[model samples]
Target: MNKFLFGLLLTSCSALGGNSQYVNPFIGTSNFGATHPGAQYPNALASVSPFNVAHGGEQNKFEKDAAWNSRVYIHENRYLTGFSHLNLSGVGCPDAGVLLLMPTTGPLELDAREYGSSYSNEQASPGYYSAQLNKYAVKAEVTSSLRTGLSRFTFPAGQSNVLLNLGLGLTNETGASLKWVSEQEVEGSRMLGTFCYHDEDVRPVFFVARFSKAPKTFGVWKKMPRYQNVEADWIGYNDSIKPYPGYRQLLSGDDIGAWLSFDTREQEAIEVKLGISFVSMENARENLDTEQPGFEFDKLRIEAQKAWDALLDRVEVEGSDEQKTLFYTALYHSLIHPNILQDANGDYPLMGQQGVGNSKQNRYTVYSLWDTHRNVHPLLSLLYPELQADMVRSAVAMAKESGWLPKWELYGMETQVMVGDPATAMIADSYLRGIRDFDVNAAYGAMVRAAEQREHNLLRPENPDYLTLGYVPVDDEGPYDGSVATSLEYYLADFNLAQLALALGKQEDHDKYLARALNYRTLFDADTGMLRPKNRKGEWLTPFDPELGRNFEPAPGYIEGNAWNYRFYVPHDTPGLIQLLGGPEAFLRQLDATFDTGNFDMGNEPDITYPFLYNYLEGQSWRTSRRVRELIAAHFGNHPGGLPGNDDTGTMSTWLAFSMLGIYPVSPGMMDYALFRPSFSKVKIHLSAEYYPGKQFVIENPVGDLDSDKPEAFTLNGRSIDKPFVTHEDIIKGGVLKVK
Candidate 1:
């Protein structure tokens, strides 16, 4: 691309307001154990991928399989599995990509993991997703939104045909059932639910898929072949594979070979309108009318682009073209989840309940706390308070409708994914900091239940061990043997819950949960002074090496990291955690030791929260300045791998955004921000009126000690302040923090 053309494109995108011309939605759309080839549009209510027998799974997943290169049936999971009407972005799990629809001929295998062809990066994009199916010599192009999708497939003129293979599953093969409801409308679908992380996090969702296509000859078939569309439109074999009024097609294969047909005139165009609802097919149709009434391809695309533009303009960055793409793309991904849960008339299906109704507060899904807690949700509390309040409320509602608060929520189902009762911290931190729109009592109830729930992702209980020992024991029988990482997370959650209980005025609950918070002491190895794992026999386990980062899967003992990563995890009671680390000087020394010893793996979440822990430590104020800058430099850039760890959806980027704006959530449940040097010279934060109008955390880089070249100095409005952190309330309620 030439400079003039680039400038023209920039100007055009600017006219569109926020959608970036530089944004290559295809960036993370490929690698990183993800089948992110871009199909299910952001915030869409359906599994809306275009027709094709490819697309493996989430972003960057196929690098492992030997047949990966040849596999065209991309069994997408953790994302809108080829636009099947539902998905969770950025999670490392598999679910909801069932019912493969291929406009093909010949034999089709109900399971797509076979024969699914590999795709190239050059084909996928934000408003468009494309790939070639080697089997049929056909090219599939898909564009989508929460409600509608436009699929255009080009095949050989003479043998033109398309088939809607209704037997495929997103990630799970069995739970998905589809049947035809009416000649035009079909519904009924189930994904038995998904196991998020191990077994602790599970998402049980039932959807009614409504297709705009006319019901033609329909039966349940799995491994059938290809065909094309004869009609200008096609009913997308809505997931009613159960019975009459249901699109249920239980196949033993050979019965449904992608449900065939073809057009003698327009082999060039075949449009598919897919509407999905956890509520019902009626609601799904209602959603389609609400979002895309006519389903005109170009108009919907323009509208989607316009919607994206409005969001992108929230924060404008001045940078190179590539940098702008990476930055804005990150921003785009950040706003995606906690999606618009309420239907057209503002109704939503409550979590843990089968019914649907109006949301008391706005409901959103996709909770990536284990990764996002560090910065993402906090960012929402700061920028989009209303939405944040809605999210907090939704989490609260889940507590009411469901038995416990959600860990990894998709729709209203809690896929007990990841570790920790993170929503505890998220809601507490939000409300305490003044995002009070969510139900306080309900929030408390959810927090309490989360703390009490014994079953975790590992499918083990917090039962005897968590209550008696204060952590997931290394001696547990499951895949997640009790180790340091799980224990540390449990302690932090307990501490956060304690704070929430106190704020809500539940004195007894406060004391109880707070005591649990201090349980980290049980895991603290006083002799070595590092928070380590304790064996079942009441003895501290030796071989305390931080660098190895064991205990997580693929590794095992730790969670998804090692000892060095897990050691600094006591954010809620950092002062207490500090004492366990020996003392302030020892703690800071250990923190510094982390930096110098090359164990500071900024790429992971277990470590990002560490830089902010200094605020709780008395003398370590200065190190935060140096470390935050270094991590930002190392992790964020104009490239794809710029994310350190999983990026855990927007969690990783939230760290960058917050750090750049000059603060860190030392204690999330509390609004206090540990001060850090600003990345940009000046950042005028967009704060909420509730958080004190006209008061934004502003930074002016007079000295610009970005490289840590100058000796650090701290001050408040020209006077040197003794402390390193400022309460978010202090910033909001109007106070001057001048640091130099």
Candidate 2:
């Protein structure tokens, strides 16, 4: 089918049925967006992604470095190493592209440079991927169950081989053990930690791999140590990871792998099933037997597609083909993380511990709370309320097991990557929005603990000083000097905690935290009218520049952002911010100037909500619409480099999805959505019955030109409303929001 016809068919199908057909997984796969066109169910444990960006291949085009090392294949890279199971998508750091399976023919070679091939005829959907290995004349297709990955490879007539390159992974940590379980099965474990180079609390991931057909011959291979001449004596250096042919029953080393050769005719196909677990190899096999016992690739693929379609069908929108594709793809990316971390039998690794625990419900990992707390969690609460509730439960469980709330959790381990106590905000927001399935008191206690604990609190490293000084002071000589940004994040977290406390009838705690939440006032430099760095004695830092932070450069007191971005970050108290900026007139002027002068950083999270701040002003809300439309057109599109920046575990994509739907959760721990002109002609959100009273909520823009900045007369359920905002309660009550 031609591109035009395929697009037309997708449009027709979306118009008549579900909208999952419009999802193009290829978007955000290049230009440092770091997304992959992998195959996985929404929030599933296992994903099968093309592992093509690694070194040691003639067709490999990318340089081997920290910048180029990613979880899976980048769109620009042009080599095929294998199909790796357990991959992460849209993450800035590399981790968890492990358990590689590559199919080849003729002479057997263990090195990726010798055996790896170039691939073409690539195609991917929500839960299915296929590519043709041009060098080996093999067709590779992959699909997945919740915990298991399934791959079917069609080989040309000859001696075909499937290589399980356990040593070749996408992580800095190396060390693996492979043992043959039977003639057709294998079980092993691989070390997969050091997320973002933290190195602490590394954990082993065990796997069980089985073949549908028994191999004619099977053996193991290891990278032998290179001989180094030392004073005329040859000494072996283990650093050289070159493949050495071996048939050992058990191979355990940094660079060791297994291979299985088969005698087959032309177009012969064989299936490989792999199961993964953080606990043990037995649980890995259990997961495989429980989730996917058969070799039915088509069945699993279709079932995975249906699962995605069902999830995407929750929100129906009518729009242009491009708009629909972008909307669904963003939604797809938003559901790929906070994955189910427990095995089928409910066994999971204990966070920061040496033991394992069992849970009745699925434990979730890969929190990335600092990023997802902005919009991703809010969107999930609105759309997938039950899943959101489970996520909250998982967080509470993690805190109870690990002694603290997660900052950047991965596989039950706290990575401590990014600043802020965002888990509080995420849980508070979800509970306030009525998705209260977890222990609220326990959650509140966890937040209080995080707030009070000074030492060993990863979320707030400067807690004691912040509590005493009402702000984190700039440290001229210390390594941790992101005081302004950290203080601002703490204020936001405190504000959310205050809201939760107020709702739970803890008036004293509410007042206490609310007072602390006003610490943003201390950072404001009235003379310059911007939030500047303050010393320990409440003195302003000299020679401050608002636009100094750009191109990933470090600002004096900011984290990955500048003053212009963090200045408008007081979302909890926008009125106070406006007051500090010399009232509404000056506030609007500065806000407009931030955009007019190109000081706004759309790719950065601190300023993502700046465009939506116009909705707070009465007449200037039109500017919000115009700026949002312009940003969407310029930064977001339907291509490989569609995203403006790192997806940040779908926070950026969630922003795009919400923008397209005409509503954004500008404030975390708040129930209301700031309204904007939606790109679609109509949008219908099927509210989850478990948490919401309404069955459906509709937003309709009958006007054809959604790009216009003019305000339309708005009515909710035939009642006129003046404000450009809708509360979560209002949405759950079910009504038509007619914009004319």
Candidate 3:
């Protein structure tokens, strides 16, 4: 590639104006937001993200090996070791950040510390990212298709080399195999799991990387582990990297890398396209050939940009530049996960099994269900019903293959990262919203099995205690405690299951599960006015503090939250809880105190709905609008530190997108949404003709003053509704909502 072609390509991309143009991929890259400014298509299987977490300890105060880091790129980090493909975004735990490719111009250096460079001039958008490596004076730019990543490096006149490091990543698991297929191609597989450090859950990712031109020299290297065996001297590299110059064979070890060196003219460009798949090596090769066929980097970039614009265009907004950037970026982050898992030939890894499965439709993976089921899935059902239906079908397939629905599924394996039967709620919520293209009967059966099976139940390990005692006591036998929080999650899951059961005409199951849903009353101690932890003898856990779990500190019986956070968690039976807390007045006072005293955490999902609970109280719906607006103003922006915290696989982003759109699906499996003021003057939700009856849904704020601290009352379609909530039917029916 030459300068003229590159300049023309940049001009062509700059000429196009779409909603994707407002998207700042760097918005959530800081503040522990866990999002990466990577080059990826919407719901893509592959992404190219800058890998800087390898060394940033003293300068940035954070490094992967020094602490529990979940992302590959940190905004403050200047060191650049490589660019990683197939990375996870906005997740709390680490996995799948592997297959690093680094370009350098110098002598061959296998050690990342010795070869890494300091980067500058970083820029990123929807489908593009570029940075200048100061150490090597090489410009690196990356773009991606659905399953393949393409990287172009402009090298100076000298010997240039590209190295693929397989040993370093966010995942602790090692062992990788690489083969120099030819002068222009290399293929291999890397073991990538032990997610959140759980040993049993593991899978292999296969990929084939092809270079645009044949290299001057290429070889594979291995870093042997320290061992005192007889063959140690024969291998010759103990606890050090051994490079095999010009070798064209297969090599397997704990830590290994392969490099391709080339003699290039000044400002010459070389491109590498990598295709990845979880199914097989052949599928990976097919994905590369089908997605790229030729080294047309600009064509792939434009296609990816268009693909993102199509999705972002679904909701058009009228707002300040900052607000539009925040909204679209949040939407962008929300769609990255639950990505396509099938290869070009529709082959995918079977869930929790040793076989290949086929799905002509998309087989989705990376389900952060415990986080996403809260708002992300519901948002998907409303905006992208077809994709949501495929996700539901994918859930059913996982249950069929693994004997249970996934809690936190990644690459066909369940890591069980968080508690709760969240899949039930997500399935029920989607089904209730008319996204029923999936096999509901099979899903319902799986739900029943998970709820009833006690002997070897993976989802509900404390099910026997809950069934026998009406609540999971703090002393019950389980993998981890947090009994009160765990029980609350189960009750919510049971409520959702009950709704689905009633919809399916299983009156008996509905009655049983609905009763179980209200079992939270057992843990609700009238003395503390909060749900306190109780032991098997029906005694409250002694020496308890309501604020024990603030800032992720350990609490006696809570998971990631405290008593104040879980106080109003009973969304299904809020009226009952209000009565239990004495009356509406007392409940309002307690809830207000929770916010006014700084107890309401906007960063975590456990209490994200607390702000909207004000709508449940009569004449106090104004508080919902006011508090939500305050949160938006304080937390979200159009910069790297914009997001509140770790996106939890877009859970927080979904909250922002829904909150800004003026309607939030506060409770999953419930049709009613808590209404608030729209952030923009007008928002147009383009409905799908195949799934929704109306062509569009409009939300208009005539006054359109976002900075004004006034609480705007909402009127649906011109009629003044007294309640602060609107049903899903009314929203999808397609009419204008006036925020007066």
Candidate 4:
């Protein structure tokens, strides 16, 4: 740790007093081309876990995406639309926050990509986003929750009217319709929100948005590719978000015109608060009234900070300036979602096959189970076990109502996106880590159903190729026609369940799942000695380019990525994989080769766990050190798009987290950690007496004996545990670690 950075670290921690403010949630705030608004109030999101400041750019809510990207509004996305809300902290895919409202006057039209304007960093903030609508000369600021946000526009003198267009296309490839309830309020949210990229569930999406400023002239418009058809839903009532979604001649991708013009003063600031509700507009209003009453910006800001403090306090860091900055930033990313979906009184509309209604519990949002199951959730369970249990119970309850466990469930819909039975992995890992607070029977049922069903079953398909050939081959006769990714994910998940079941005393189920855990071996191409792909009859794909994408080679590799990424993805079997790679020497060689060749695609998630594999190779300890140091320094920069890939709601940053702490969780259901080189000479994990009374994870550098000019070294609990590897139980129980 450099002295300058380290000194800055001291003052920053000192300011936090009992909690930390060292984390600049705004760091990655601009990354992915936009900054995440760690300030807005989400009733469902526990608090603002501001981990990174990587830039995406400034927006309305610090997090909410705006009309057109202010900085770089390039078509085909590829960067950002300047929108960031109901967003995963770090993951790569884009999801919620639809109905992008832009303020324009004089013959309002649609076609957002064209109508939207651009701005610079000086325009955005937490809970507020401002940009000069290039064409209209209007300055706009936007803010919101997963369901609703408010836009306050200061119009130029000529146009006092504010515009609200439902046809302004957003993500998810769906259009929205507006029913003019009053001059100021439009009763609707984004219609048919985006899918979970993987196309998981096929449920209609709906949200009711109540705007603050009524328009002098307000009406609905249908978006046409080139223009718009402004219409009026005059006498009709917008009952709620439930029944009205599919019953209309709503706008299309072509109909891009809708606007609400409201008269305003020249020097006037019209603040529009749009309350969103999954169940009803009444509920959205109720949520707004409870959390954010009367636009008191200061009050909201304080409340937002308080929420962030509560979560950041879960762990504490003491290190160099840069190290602490990275630490707090990583910590901030950790709590971005699984947002609080219910109202203040504890009620939320469930997104299920049964459709719109209040949930059994406070339904959570921002599920990155596929990305987070590995470490993010595990980290959460380790600190906030009670919350982990609640989340587990929430998953189970959703499964009970929806028939099958949803992949990426949002309000009343299962956007079956992403691969893997991650719900199973999360539950299983939580249970194994001592976070068993759900219906054991129901959880096991979901777990078994996911693993046992035929591959074609919508809820739980029996994987024929997975069952027969041990991998998903292109030539396999189908029921389930997907990628090898699902099988690989299921293999990991099933293994976790098997271990969890064994611990929970479900013997038969344990044995069944245990057998399923070995399914990864089917894809293990012994010829290449790496987990590769094959044809149905067990023949390797011809001219298989492990680096090629799925569409080209299909089942020869997993979905979304190549075999190189997935090859070392066996978290449950590092030792087996190490052995398969020929031993510690060969394992180290191959891992080195993966990185040395620079083919590890830091731009993806599969190989995230790969860097830490050196910990298992006994004598080859330094490799882990080198890789950890290099990865943290290279990909995790302090800029937007600074990420090697989608933060995966924080999985990547969480990887930074463990790396910064000098440890990483290699197994989903295991409590042990594969060690690495600590970025600082010392790091302390704050422990709670409630969960872990009289406990803490203390890392004291072994090089403490050296002078200030000398380099730093590590030691654990006083004695240096030469080589790598540690356990969750070790640190949480609090023993002094001397790494000097």
Candidate 5:
């Protein structure tokens, strides 16, 4: 089909159907967004993403090894390696971008550099992606179920081959084992981890790839290690791809792959489906059989699209085509992580342990707590409370099995990627927002243990000093050594924990954590109006520059950002922070300075709530609305580079989604949302019947007030709401919020 006809067909299909049609999956695929236009189901364990980072072509600006490339596919990169299954999306670190499946014609090429081709005619939606390989005139399309990935490749009449390259991946770790289970099946386990370059936190991911038709011939190959000694002369296959034609047994090596060759008629289409699990190979195959029993590509594609539509339908909006596309795409990215981890039979790898565990409900992975704790979990609590409840259960289960809450968990393993005890805040926030189906007592106990366990505390190494000095001392050496930043994170976590304690009627614990939560005040410098680094002697560090850590450069007491970015980061106690900053007027001035001086980083999490801070000052809420609208206009759009930076596993996207919806959960543990003017004429949010009292909540802008950033006033359910904010309770008793 021509581009114009294809566009018309897509428009017709979208008009006839669901919200998934509004999603542009490729929006965050560029400008370091770390999101790929992959075929992913909402919160699915498996995804099929085009792998293009391994080989560098003239069209490619970034390669896997050239820089800190954390994604499997880049929007600008035209070179295509294969479709990698079991991929991680919107992450800043590399892991799980493995199990490459590619098709080539004429001759079998095991090397990715040789088999890789430039691709064109790329297209993607919520649950599907397709592209035409320019080199071989072949078309590749992909879709997925909950735990399985499916791909269809159309080849020209010739000798065609499908290769499953186990060696090439974005993971830092190495070594894999591949075996031919049958003529039409291949099973393998690839070592994946060292996330963010940590060596000891590695684990194997098992997968089973099944083909639609048996190959004419198949073989497993290994790239033998090159020898430097005299034996090099005799080793012909050393450093070269060694093929074992028809060898069906198992082979283990750092660089190995399997290829299946066959002669095809004109435009012959072959399907490959993959099932993956963290527990075992049998479970992987079982997941495949249970989720995908047949090779009906279009049927599965429609089913996957419907699955996405169900999730996307939660928020319906009326807007322009571009506006709707950006809104739905952001919503799409936000729902992609903390995915289902358990296999078909409810079995998953025990958290940081050496055994299999079973969950009656869904077990979730990819915590990315430091990022998702801010907005993603809270968003889920409102829109999909049952899923949020399972996620809370997953966190508590992790504490039971691993003895500590996950910091940046992946595949049930603690990478300890980011700082602070974010899981405490996540669970407490979920529970405070009325998601209380999990064991709150056990969760609180875990929080207290991580808070008080000074020795060998995995979550908080700065705990001992924090307990004594009321803040993390700048003297400590390690990842958690960001005294001001780490201390700020702990304060937020402690504040959330205190709220949970108060809700559970533990006054003593509440008082204790509440006091500890105020420790952020100890790091505040009245002179600079920013949190400054302090040592054990209660002395501020010399030569303080609030902008020292800008652009992710290291400062004395900050991580990922400067002190100015974190100045207004005290979300739990904005009043206290405002008082410390000299008052509401001074706070507003400093906050304005942060934005006016180019110090506000919309990409990072520390400063995400700054725009919403204007809601705290009386009648200054218009500033919040204006800043949010301007930020969205400047940083987001309906293109590959729409996102400002890394989605941080949907943190940035969730921020955008919430901003577009005219509400901001300024603090996680808080039940209230700071309101603003939405970007749409009408937005209807379908509430979960199991968790919410009302059926739906709608925000209406009847006068087309979207052109203006700020609203004069607001009325909920036909009654005036004095302040530009609403509680979780108010929203769940759902009705329309009309902008006047």
Candidate 6:
């Protein structure tokens, strides 16, 4: 065995103690969460998810909506076309559900409409999936390694075939190329980009597929235009499009595919293994050879399960079966993105550049930083310090290659989606928590460059105005909105930068950024007790309504939410927020009114920490525990539609995970965790000793009444604490947290 394979086996063996059997991979597959019950190892490069929505016929009725265009939508149950090899989970936008593979019997059919089948007896777990194709009488089972996907298909007697569909995918970007290496192997590449309609940074993903048995007959298929008459064909006029089959070694077009036909007996099984890479087809094959060298289906499936078990075992919990399912599933979802982006040989595509770059460690991608910076990175720093550090290194490397930090990066390309300089906050938070293995100096330099420079297509589009006027101005007459929201995000980013600057002993930068971090105060309107829009003339915009932007409607000064939700988003300075709202009694009254008047949006990130703000108050902190429990019970479950909203690349799940663990990081780039009442009686966290000083951190609620409205007293390591918070240093040092 190779050294990399040996290391992976050792890692998987060490993590075998966790109960991965409790993980329900289908938890957030419905209710618009956009999660897929795919077979994937934790933080792996590829996932084999069922592509059911695109099948024609009765399934088309339920799949007509725009939401069905997502990576995988499980609500529609009429047909099963194939299993897509690369898919995104719990994301709002569509990207990278390509490289589809399907099995069939009888005459070979290339069209998805003709080859689709109805499926039943479906089952899924972490790193494994299985389904019975009723129409073809084929049983399909799949498992995965970090960079490869393995599938075993059982077919009945008669002519059997396996099809590789390159044209049909979840992405809006089209065009692909495929080449056959031999009867049993093929290589291909597909274009992927246009995330949320931003199409400037398109890139190609390459893959290699190998079948266990060589096909008796193999050929390629394409959906080409059909000519009507001889005269019309001479004039290049076409009547319709049809699938044309041929024995071609190479094919390239917007719609093309390949098929392999095999003769098999009853209950005969064929296994296909596929490897994917963003760099080259050679790397793809190498990844497959190194990670999964053989067609050992059951053995690989068991290893995948053990891989997940080791990851979930990091946080062992004592709870009911239902709670355990949700917790482990959330943890599972949290580790899917920021996935390993480099090939096994450490070769990765340089962001915004043409050539491939090499790194010593895994170069991670899919950083939904605007959402994940709030909680996901903090959770990783606490439990998986080495992985978190590698992610930080990935960000720093992106900045070096692309000349700007990534906002919503995917597969080595910046999508420029969402607002905020959140990568800075995430890196700063990790560094403060002792995840400093990355180039801290270079990271700090990147943060400073993003904060000071106003570059095009970067996060700080309104940086000039922000620097000159202390905030981004509302362009009511023009196309721009979200001035208030953007400014507040910048303020948080600046706060995190200031903290990092202070830690690095750069006093001048510390003073400059610390002053800029208060820019959110300039947008606050004392008369309305909420943030409002300001024009270039430094005056509040006329006719403001705090509740105007509800349910994702565009308001004059907000993005995806209203002033009520964004008002308390000053997590870095809650005391200042309370002071702005008046005294403690008035602040509590207004906060209570927000919940009573139905202004709370649990599905969004800005208001996620709103319920936890009560912990900052001394005697009234019990309200946080009460509200957290209520939200979890109302929104989260073990069913298909379990999550309240899009997982935002596991940000929502991380929030639930931290809440159930009885602690939350109120602010990134800070060490303190806001305490809450944990759902379980006992919780144990296995900390990585490479970065943390402790082996384990335990939380015990001996009362066992998770429904308790308030926590009366708290102690850490047998010492009494009057405050409702604990530092990262405190937890990493190892101790028992007892709440009463």
TM of each candidate vs. truth = 0.79, 0.96, 0.96, 0.80, 0.97, 0.95
How does each model score on lDDT?
0.57, 0.85, 0.87, 0.58, 0.87, 0.85
Candidate 6 wrong stretches, greater than 4 Å? 1-17, 66-68, 227-246, 455-457, 476-481
True-structure lDDT of candidate 2: 0.85
Q: Which lDDT tens digits does candidate 6 get at residues 1-740?
A: 23233223323423344567667777777777888887988899988988877856666555665344674646556577888898898888888888999999998778788899888766777788888998899999898989999999999999999999988888879999998888788999999999888878698899999999988898887777764567545546443324444455678988888889989989999999999999999999999999888889888888888888778889989887677777887888999998999999999999988899999898999999989999999999998888898999999999989888889999999898888889989988888999888888888878888888865637688888888999989964233348888888899999999998888898898889989988788988999999889999989988888988876877888878888988898889899989998978888988988888888888888889988888877787789989889999888987777899898999889989999899999899778899888888999999897888898999999755778774558899999888999999999999899888
User: Which parts of model 4 have CA positions greater than 4 angstroms off?
Assistant: 1-95, 103-115, 121-158, 173-175, 194-267, 356-360, 459-462, 469-471, 477-484, 550-555, 688-690, 702-716, 719-723
The Cα error of candidate 6 at residue 273, in Å, is 0.6
Q: Which digits, one per residue and each the tens of the lDDT, describe model 1 over residues 1-740? A: 23333334334433354544545443333234132435545545443443233335544344344222211223332211233334444445555554444544344333444435433322433455565665555666666666545565566544343444444443432444445555444444554344442343333333333333443344444432344445855534423122122234442332233343443243455555555555565666677667766647766666666666655554544435554655566665666666766666667776665677685455677676667665778777766677677777777777777767767776566666666667777777787777776578877766666667555522224545777666656665345443667666676677777777777778998898788777777777766666666677766555556555443443345766666777777777777777677788788888877778776666567777787776666656566777777776666654334455445666665667677656777766766678866655554454566645645555555544555634456665566767777766656654445557
Model 1 clashes, total count: 104
lDDT of 5 by residue, 216-279 (tens): 9899999876565565465433467789999988899998999999899899999999999998
Superpose all Cα atoms of candidate 2 onto the true structure and report the RMSD in Å to 1 decimal: 2.3
Q: What's model 6's lDDT at 680?
A: 87
The TM-score that candidate 3 achieves is: 0.96
Our tally of clashes for model 6 stands at: 1
Query: Residue 649, candidate 5: how far off, in angstroms?
Result: 0.6
Candidate that beats the other on lDDT, 1 or 4, i.e. the better one: 4
Q: Compared with the true structure, what per-residue lDDT tens digits does model 2 show for residues 1-740?
A: 24444344334323224567788777887766778887878899899989878774445556555353764877767777888898887788888888999999997888877787878877777787888999889999999988999999999998999999987777778999988888789999999888888889588899999999998888888787667899999776745344434354677988778889999889999999999999999999999999887899988887888898899999999887788889999999999988999999999998878899999987899999889999999999999998898899999988888878899999988889888899999999998989877899998998999899988776788898899999888866243357888888999999999999999999999999999999899899988888898888888878898888766677888888788878888989988899889988899999998988878887768889998898888877778889899999888987777898788889889989999998898799878788878899999999998888999999999756687766756789999878888898999889899877
Better of 2 and 4 by lDDT: 2
Candidate 4 has its poorest 10 consecutive residues by lDDT at: 238-247
Clashes of each: 104, 0, 0, 97, 0, 1
Candidate 5 backbone collisions, by pair: none
The deviation in Å at residue 291 for candidate 4 is 2.3
Q: lDDT tens string, model 4, 1-740?
A: 23244234333423334344455444443445233533344234322221111123332334244333322122112212223223344434444434344566555444344344444322222233344555666665554443445556667665554444443232444554455455544555455444534454333233334455555655555532223334843443321111122223343332333355556667566765555555555676676666556755434444444655676666665565567667766766666556666665566665465444455555676576777788888888776676676677778877787667766666556766566788888887887766655787898887777776775544435365566656666664232333566667878877888888888787997888778777777667767766665666677667777666523244345666677777788888888877777888887777888788665866566777887787777655566667777877787754444456556667777888888776778888777887655676666676756566546676655444312322224456566676566777776677766543
